[model samples]
Target: MSSSQFQLIKEARLKNNCPECYSNDSLELTIKQKLSETQFYKSITNEIVSDINCLNCELQIFPVRWTDDIEQVVNYHKRGLNLKTKSVALKPISWGIITFFTVIIIATILFATGVLVL
Candidate 1:
């Protein structure tokens, strides 16, 4: 994240109106847990880092971009919260919905044609 993005997120967080901000607490906890699970830091070169802090929550976030220039990048990984993607159980629910609608449509067509007999 850049300084601008950090400021924006911080403002949004302070407002406490955005869902993302509301989840920040839980997100931070998860991030801590993830950090404990494995080594999360990596440095390819020194120059490709960027550091930005949230204005509202004052959370320091380090977001890094890989670049050839090592001197230009700061310690970006230190300033931001790291999160992981949670496995969502959507396949079953999605299939169920499709099946449900298919059945409804078929039944409706049958009833409309008098084949379903009420």
Candidate 2:
């Protein structure tokens, strides 16, 4: 891992405990790095997860990452350091539903027109 990747993982591991896990007996953090390429050059991505187990309950939490004028990730966990009520965007599910229907419709049309025989 690169220095930046190590730093990100270290930062995530040192973060404070989850508010909901106040009564938990154990908590830990695991970090991972993924490399990718953009239009310019290669970049390192970081992902951190807090593993907590307490009172017969287990959970994982992640921190928020954002840049100027851009929001990368959103916090939607049930309990955490900054607990609050907020809007949760379920856009991915909507897109999946639309895409499923569109694909089926297109495939049906193609089959009916004998353009696609399988």
Model 1 regions lying over 4 Å from their true place: 1-90
Tell me the TM-score of each prediction against the true structure. 0.27, 0.25
Q: Candidate 2 lDDT (Cα, whole model)?
A: 0.40
Tens-digit per-residue lDDT, 1-118, candidate 1: 1111111111111211212233222212111211111122222212222333444454554324222222122223234534333322334556787899999999999999999995
> What TM-score number comes out for model 1?
0.27
Model 2 segments beyond 4 Å from truth?
1-90
Q: All candidates' lDDT scores? A: 0.34, 0.40
Question: Over the stretch 1-118, how does candidate 2's per-residue lDDT look in tens digits?
Answer: 2222222232122233344554332334433333444333444443333332222235543233222211111132212333122222334555688789999999999999999999
